[model samples]
Target: MGKGGESIPDEEWERFLREAEAGVEGAPEEPSARARMVARRLREESGRPEPWRGHPPARRQRGKGWYAFGLLVAAALLVVALDPGLVAGWFGGGGGDGGSAPLAVESKRPDQPPPTEAAARRPTVGQPFRGSPAAQWGDGTAGIGLPEARATGWMDKGQVAQALEKSRDFLVASSLDPGVLRGERPRKAIALINPHQRDVQDYLATAFRAPSRENDPVLLFSRFDRTKVRLVGDVVKTRGRITYREGKRGAVEVTTDVTYVYPAVRAAAGSDEVVRTIVRREVVMSWDDPAKVITEPGTFSLVSYKADTTNGGCATPTGYFTPEFGPERAASHPADGAEVDPYDRSKSMETRMREAGGAGCGTATRS
Candidate 1:
């Protein structure tokens, strides 16, 4: 009786219905910011517009027709009781054909029409449908955090397409949100570096065989010897990826795993020489500020002994040392007692080399 169960007065129902019949498409009103964002995110992830992506809000616009109809039905029932003879005769079809005529025989309530299947499927008399765009996109929007998104109401088909376009360029590096554990957010973003084997080999050759170390004198037979030098043979590779949110803050997080085929090398150890142990490392780098944020030497960690032993040739978060960084050291010396560099070999390796060479008499060599 009331068109769409709206609160329109009886007189207004006729006008609105007439307008609808005249081919006017009803539109949903605009929604609030929170509602809009929710709807937007929903549509973006789903790849389709929700039924209420951007339509008018709910409010009473039809009331008179329903009220009048309810009164009419009540009046009809009252008339039946007031005149039992006419009412009973009318209902008692076998009594006579006069009251049992076709119109009277097929009598039904006149206040409202029967409900249809489509009408039943619609939102209840007072509620609105909150359509989800997710119902459409599925895995296509695999990286989206479903609960974090927002969208508007009364959306049309084109709105879904717009959401997809907006979502494509997003890159989330680190997901620090605790909500994931509580089922609040979905899909954490991860960055990856897929380096080829050949690429790794090239980097290793450059880093190991480029003859970059400074020339220094070593100790032999309790004297400083020029021929004694650090011998190193390494085959290494590197790659980068974004690991977490900070990575996405200004750069892409990358995981560069290096598997080296290191060869034996001899280094001066006071009166003797020895090859260093093989090494392995896991390096994490960021893409945006690649050079500025990671493994640059003394600043960002060049290598992290994250899951491997230090003797495994693993690098730590040490800054890169260039020729201009500092002066070269005099190799291990017997007089220095600890095969440590006479100039500046007090570092871990330098101290170890000196001690192993049996030259270190326990004198502390400050690097």
Candidate 2:
């Protein structure tokens, strides 16, 4: 039986063992660049603290099947080394022309886990979204659906609609834009903010110019280190709502509470493993009635901004998000708070943030 208790044909297993043994025997004395990269990744995944020596560790007596299985694993890695495209195909290549079989998108409640073991497996080249809550989510801007706008106590229906549209634009620019995701300055998002709000302007300027733990740019933008990782696909799964209500002093406050899921893999050529980072941002922007208050004619002033990041490492201090690839990475960057489920959007952002213990890292129940 296979790991998941599925029956494996005797002939197929024997064929695999024979091929793996042959590959191992024919491997070159010096590992190729691809092989080295794969080896490094495996080592990292293994969570070993010791450095690798030139020679393999002393082997102990074990069943022949176990020994052969080890060889099979090594041979599989060798196959990956020989064909870099195999890795790309496993994680949904940019062109989608790879010949790997894609997994069906599983149907489940947004807060529920994968229904079957097969559905819970790590995503393959053809099924990059498998095992994720985001598999069924709408892509990018399409997911940020706007609510029906109506006249507030102070603002007209047109003005309310404008405010909602502007809020949506800011969410796209800050969270879903490819340029912003690749760590570029969010110029378009910044442009939407009211300049008359000096405090917000100053805060943003400081965050961009000299980011620190207190003034991290990630609080406003979803960014990653381009040098370290690249997005798996063009799609960024998003789900959230935009709401507007009457605020103090005759202003219309628009609040966007959205969660963004990003799938990424190491930037290296042969690296194929995909890891996801979840960011939930709640931003409040208000437009004051022109007759009641002096403000930027069309721009909205920042009222409040809060974000909760999951599967991003605890010690991430570079402003760019650090994706935790596996349990080893999570162990290395142990969070201080309780495990929070990133996929559960039932609770309000404020409640989730409160549960996460504000500004501190918390382990995600699942990616």
Candidate 3:
């Protein structure tokens, strides 16, 4: 019936017949387990085959209908070749899929794990890798423009000094500030409370150096790394008592409530750490207990502050600012606001000028 001896590919004939037959039922879900297993086995086997050493034998025709359809398509193609414009018009203007519009192609990137650790190491703690020095400065500074200074009249030096004095004098106050300290208990109480923490002794021994002999010779304390402090020889033994208080801003701060005794070099210009020892070290730790809705004083409000853990503690991190402005303070002072006095032209006067401008702020020039 077809006018040709050649047969069509089985797939093409099968698809053509399927479409031509029409009125087919939708595929069923939950295919039998046997069929599912067989399909999977077929898909796996499809990956490899025996190599053909020579020209393979031609495939045999399983049905005569394929040969007829093949001849019809061959004739149609020959006609289309002679009149491409006419074929295009009939098929809505394209070669692909009889001009039924090409399928929209989509490309998807393969699944990848989130770059969390890498991001953590970025220019700042927020990024993947260690950030550039400039980025670290900018981010750690909490977006405070460099050349920053305390805003005009923000913190009066006199007032700040008075407040600090009061803080220092709190120990002398006969009565403690009640309703201020939470989970407040003596050091002995902690051991009684958590008797299971075997490491508490180690923590105390290392964190707070207890006096060994009654009269270890006095040694000056100096700037030293905590890790290297244990190696110091001719150590100074001192007696001290520390107390913990939940800071007004939701932080657990250990303070030297009373230094019953402590060591110091008798030197006129004392550098305390000739053989430094930690007597009353304050560990500013976080209080993970549920926060309280404390109504701060009208003048100085209670605030919550998180330690600067980002950027390897090189700079401050989140939750350190006042509520209105936020928790960050600048690292340097800018001189824009504080003009130079004509009288002080000396190079040694530069530090004084910066100190005069602001207590703590950094600034950057506008680009």
Candidate 4:
């Protein structure tokens, strides 16, 4: 008993909508039994003869209430099939402002599958590290930056070489004292070390303490001396031997011995001082078993460093008068094929040093 003569209840209207929406394109074409009965009653009430002669009509005539109910059901279903939003609004499912939200019909592309956990966890290898080029650079050299080595497949001798190359490049870039002062060099370089090694952590911590309290000079210079030095422009040669040691509890130790031919030069009082140094480092990496790769941090940490230098490698330079001073004796000299005077100047220091037959200042010693 709504504004209309007789209105369908809210519950019945909702049911009609659900049914219509479920089978909008598959509704039966013929009228329902109730509808047919109602039609017969209308014909009988109007005093029209039945289509079937002689005997009474096949279906009993329905009351006006049944007729009204059947017509209402058909009308509600038709309206729902035509416009679901209007029915939803009529059932109080619309917004408070007398509007209804559109039906959210889901559609997915046929070829694309849903994402999975494994796909999300795929390793990012062979991809370049994207960051500020300056942040990646070692010792301010253009194009020389942090390592691009990511965890790919299993670790092998070749992969170890790539990691060693990153360390060596860091060293070459750190020849300038200014690069060491940047502080990022140590942080980035330490990323290679396994964080589980307390000894390595202690060593790095001791080396990078207060400005005057640090010990490891070869790794980080104790003082920022104006000694313009650069590694000689020669192919860095490396000889490594990989050793695997098995232990109890399924732990395996993978060790490597790497020897590097490091030639370098430092400016000393208008003369190019050649310093030939060879570094033999031992790296101990850990793996789960024979088949597993050691991808943990500090697995490739440097456990031992033995640097042999030809000149001024062990002692600090002595100043005659002011702070700006060089070594007393120019004794350490470069190897035969190494470059002595690579820096551009009016006169080449290499010529003068070569004529002098090996010029070096102090005895080269290990740090």
Please write out the lDDT profile of model 4 over residues 38-122, one tens digit for every residue.
5677676856655431475335454666788999999999987776544654664532122323222212111331111111111
The true-versus-predicted C-alpha distance at residue 277 of model 3, in Å, is: 24
Per-residue accuracy of model 1 over 28-95 as CA lDDT, tens digit each? 23433444565677868855654543564344434666778899999989976665434544563311
Clashes of each: 67, 5, 32, 19
Query: For candidate 3, what is the TM-score?
Result: 0.14
Per-residue lDDT tens digits of candidate 3, residues 1-367?
Answer: 1236355465754554465467356533443344355457667776664332235445555346678899999998997777554365356442212223322211221133112121111111122112111111111112111111221122344433433333323322211111111111223212221232344434334332442222110110112222212121222221222233445444333232211111122132322322111211111222212244222221122111111111111122111111110122233333444333211212222353354454222232210
List TM-scores for all candidates, in order: 0.17, 0.67, 0.14, 0.32
Find the 10 residues in a row with the least total lDDT in model 1.
216-225
lDDT of each: 0.27, 0.74, 0.27, 0.37
- For model 1, what is the error of residue 341's alpha carbon versus the real structure, in angstroms, after optimal superposition? 31
Arranged by TM-score with the best first, the candidates are 2, 4, 1, 3
- Sequence-dependent TM-score of model 1: 0.17
Cα lDDT tens digits, model 2, 108-149, are 224543232222446655566656656656677676668788
**Winner of 1 and 4 under TM-score:** 4
Give the 10-residue window scoring lowest on summed lDDT in candidate 3: 304-313
* Alpha carbon deviation, residue 269, candidate 2 (Å): 1.6
Task: State the TM-score for model 4.
Answer: 0.32
